[model samples]
Target chain A: MCESIPKTMKAIVFHGPHDVSTEIRETPKIEKADDVILKVKYSGLCGTDLHSYRGHIKGPVDQIIGHEFLGEIVAKGSDISDSEFKIGDDVLSTFTIQCGICWYCKHGYSGQCDKTNTFGKVGLPGGQAEYVRIPYAKSTLIKKPASQDHADDSVYVLMADIFITGYYGVKKIVDFLGQKPAVGVQQLEIKDATILQYMVLAPLGVGPVGLCALRVLNHLGFKKVVCVDNVPSRLEEAKRLGAYKTINFETEPTLLKEVIEKDTGNVGFDAVLEVVGASAALKTAYDSVRRNGFISSLGMGHEPLPFNGLDCYLKNINISFGRCHVWSLFPEALEIFETLKGDFASFIDHKVSLDESKEAFELFDQHKVSKVVFDLTL
Target chain B: MCESIPKTMKAIVFHGPHDVSTEIRETPKIEKADDVILKVKYSGLCGTDLHSYRGHIKGPVDQIIGHEFLGEIVAKGSDISDSEFKIGDDVLSTFTIQCGICWYCKHGYSGQCDKTNTFGKVGLPGGQAEYVRIPYAKSTLIKKPASQDHADDSVYVLMADIFITGYYGVKKIVDFLGQKPAVGVQQLEIKDATILQYMVLAPLGVGPVGLCALRVLNHLGFKKVVCVDNVPSRLEEAKRLGAYKTINFETEPTLLKEVIEKDTGNVGFDAVLEVVGASAALKTAYDSVRRNGFISSLGMGHEPLPFNGLDCYLKNINISFGRCHVWSLFPEALEIFETLKGDFASFIDHKVSLDESKEAFELFDQHKVSKVVFDLTL
Candidate 1:
């Protein structure tokens, strides 16, 4: 396993706030019984990665930083069973390491496992590199579905986090709507087509996360989903991806009235997807949802949510807030990616070599680019 | 149809805050063709009634004031199907009027229906009377289940609101746990008995609502439930109702430490049932829940919930807030009542005559009594 490996490989290293560079580093090896060394194929930029770039999450300087990675395993540990996984198997990983035996891991709470560790921070060098060591690889890395074998690996990088996250929130909304996907095909068909009376709000104008959610919503036979943002171009992008309506909340002084009075006949929406992670946007979601409605919010905001218990109770609002747990829903997201690979790739407008880590982060920070992926093959 | 009924009857009339009196009033008649007259049997005094008494919810003063009622249909509208419900059938009424034709009612959101009006407020006389007019009788009232007909009518009164509320919140917990009941019996059994490592917190020491929830939790075969309160008597009551652990937060200097370190071994509870509608209690629920845990909060509070968006995001918390819609879960509550009628009635320490309206309200307001019901037969 070590004979053919290089002594040094290029990795995007985080030096400080607004400081990231592709630097030569010694290749990682399989150090543990369950560890596997993955040859990184493609890795995408994410909001959490930006948190490091902007200094909001502060110094873990000189470490490789990216959690969304899809790749092929080049080496495996002795304890790793070959039947479940083998060397050269193509795979995708969750944002964090998971010890499969923990209470959280066994119960489908992959994000909060007892032995969980994020790949990019706290001393774990992430996949913005040529080769990465994955501990607990048997549990952490899922095989690339045969259905998506031919799909672009960049598209599957979305599966590592954003696509699954988008899918997670949409699945929750389906639960809220009481919509059950058909047993075999597993496409959520709203029981009554007339249930189009129920509307959903997804912020598809910001990032790939919301657009991916929009894509799943349309695939589920929903016809009353709305997307909102200030940018006309993003709103147009959302509309192109099957958003039923769009609101430029920046320009519309009557955003609430329009959504409530025009779109939903004054009852407001049945569910809202909050991906903006801002109090103002959360307020809009709260204000637009009808009594007994639910909000599936995955936005990672640092601000306090603007909500009072009495206000929520009075309207009978239901809200589920969290980051997506990426284990169970991985295959489902891959299944989705098989059909909408190009549509998902449309959001990833920037694909560059690891050397452009500085430019990519800068462009993403300025909102000049919506999504970026490092082509490690480059 | 109501020829045998008396012209005048005893009623509890709210003249002002802290001023309720038993007075003889003209018996209610079927004023609308959609109305049905119910001969009140048992009427529960609720926390909302205290809201009126304490002038918190300034009311339609001088009106009959009770929403939780069990009764016999004395007379009914011509449109009310005699085949479905003949005169003299025992029935239970939801706390509010529900018009079945509305989208809310059709979709099981009976609490927020198009024609939702609380029975005790806004000029509609509630069930604190010998005879009460029930509008939307076809949809508002449900027949007493044959199983619970022989049980205490007061326990069935619990079904009208609190029992169902407790059940609603618990059902959400079941959803959160991803525990599905058996297809036939519909009792949520944890897939693995060892999964009891997941804990739940229900404030069973506060009121009949929490105890009623505790009853449902145990019936579902859940083994680990903790109850918290300052009162020793309430904690004892909770223990009697099958709480596995009780924490008196007031006396415990290390309340969070005890629950986190000792009870759950440092990971917090898997779910929290929030029925105490105060900021402090909500904070406790927020603190005690583990990452990826859910808080099924039905607590209606006036103050802002003490939480920041970032903290909730970091914890990956899931919270659902609402008043329970009583229509769909009524039969399920009756099923629980069939088994736990005595246990539910154990919490209702006050059973008084209609003439004792003032006494019952005073006792409940002062916390001298846990639950009170007007026994019309007295």
Candidate 2:
């Protein structure tokens, strides 16, 4: 796979707020016994990566900036074994890794593990680079479908972040209060459990997280996936993906409440997923859910939205805030994706060569793509 | 029992903001068949009564303000039958009366019944006078203990309002979602059930409501009752009543965090009682409890406290608000009070004659008394 031992590899790094540039950096090395080296074949730029680019949410400046990726394992540490994986195996590694023995991992909260390590920004070098080292390799990497060619990375790569995140985020609704996955069933034993038969996804920003939420809800037989967003393109995309209804925030300033009450008998929506990391979206998500309903906010906002304690007490709603643990859910999410193989590939809106990485980020910064893939072989 | 029928009995009227005076008016005639006349033997003043007196909370200017009381049933209307109650019987009536047929009553929330009526500030002539009319007599009046004399009105009257209010407040933790009380176990044969183990009672202002909460909790065997109040005097009362912990907002500004982390193990309290009608206290009760916890607020607040919808949604909390359904729980509460007997009198901090009623209001208004009892016969 190596053409030569180069001094550096092409990567997209944030120069400062609102600026991203392509630069050369030495290929990352596996530093620990549990580490594996992988050559990134496809990487998707996310809204959070854009936030990092804009310096909205704090992170390391000048750090490698993409997280969603599919790649091939090229090397392994001495302590690594091939029980389920081998060098040269095509796979998707989540942005995060958990040792499976942590307080968070043992409790099924691998996303919040005290010892969690992420790929992009604030951790070992990210997948934006040509070669990246993955720690706790077994916990992070999920083998791609055996029938697929290496060139088909776009179809399965999302199992790395977006797809699994949506699945994991909903799973968290049941997992947050329980000791294990089994215990989550116990949590639902709460009496007068208000039944949430309808769900609304707020501010459907043009990204995989929101779409994956819609896709998964559809797959689970939720007949109505109300989409709320001002942008016509995103709303259209949502409708195309089988959303039962779409509300343009421009036409309906109170779209969230209007849609929720209309569908859920003038009370509230059963569950609301805040995919857009905006204060207004967060507030809408909070206000539109029914009593004892669930809200999962996957996007981290720039500032802490002001909270009203009295209404919260009076309404008795539940709000969960955290990053997604794609690693913990890849197996199931990948199974779903592989079952519908080529259908998932349509999520890729653009493909760019490593040499065009800078322009790809610029387009992403300008809201030009939903999913952008970096083609290493180009 | 009939004294000369004065055109008016001695009445306390709220002329304007904080302007209260005792004046005599015609004793109100019972025009409805469901109504009964009670000779107010021992009427208690509550913080909500003070609210009406001070005009902090709005009520009719000429309204006679007393809701909590124990008295003698001197007269009954044609529709009254002594199935569970009778005339010449010493009894206590709740501030509210449920028709026992409305959706609310059928659902066990007798407080919010469609035909329910309230005495005192809520569009009814209160018991501050020598007699007051109680509608829906069968559901509103509870016969006093057979072994007790009329002199026990000081404590027995509290059971009609404050004590039962506190008792039913804990009913919010009854696992109602798991199984209805009237329903059999065979109906809920599902093996999986989430049981609640802890409850948090946040009494915003420590007056009668908070104290009654302590007395009721002490009777129900709930070992962890955390009383939250802004006043040191109220906290002292909470401590004396055997509260597991008292969160003093004046002392600890981060009272919510402390209460949740310490008492709730950082998840949240099982049931939160917003006894204090203050907006801030309502807010604390909401923020301190965990997901799936119960929030029950009694009476109205001066201003609407905006709620935190997201936080509540993530936690699966449920909010219920209304006046106490004193009759629904009076039988059990009377049993508890009977068991306490003379000991329940500790709640009576001040006992005054009918002539000293003005002074009683002043002490209750100044927060000097936990409960003020008016002895008319003296």
For model 1, the DockQ equals 0.40
Candidate with the greatest DockQ versus the true structure: 1
Residue range A345-371, candidate 2, lDDT tens digits: 777888887677677877877877767
Itemize residue pairs with steric clashes in candidate 1. none
Cα lDDT tens digits for candidate 1, B271-340: 8999977888888888888877888888878888899888888787878787887775666566677777
**Per-model TM-score on C-alpha atoms:** 0.88, 0.68
lDDT of 1 at B308: 85
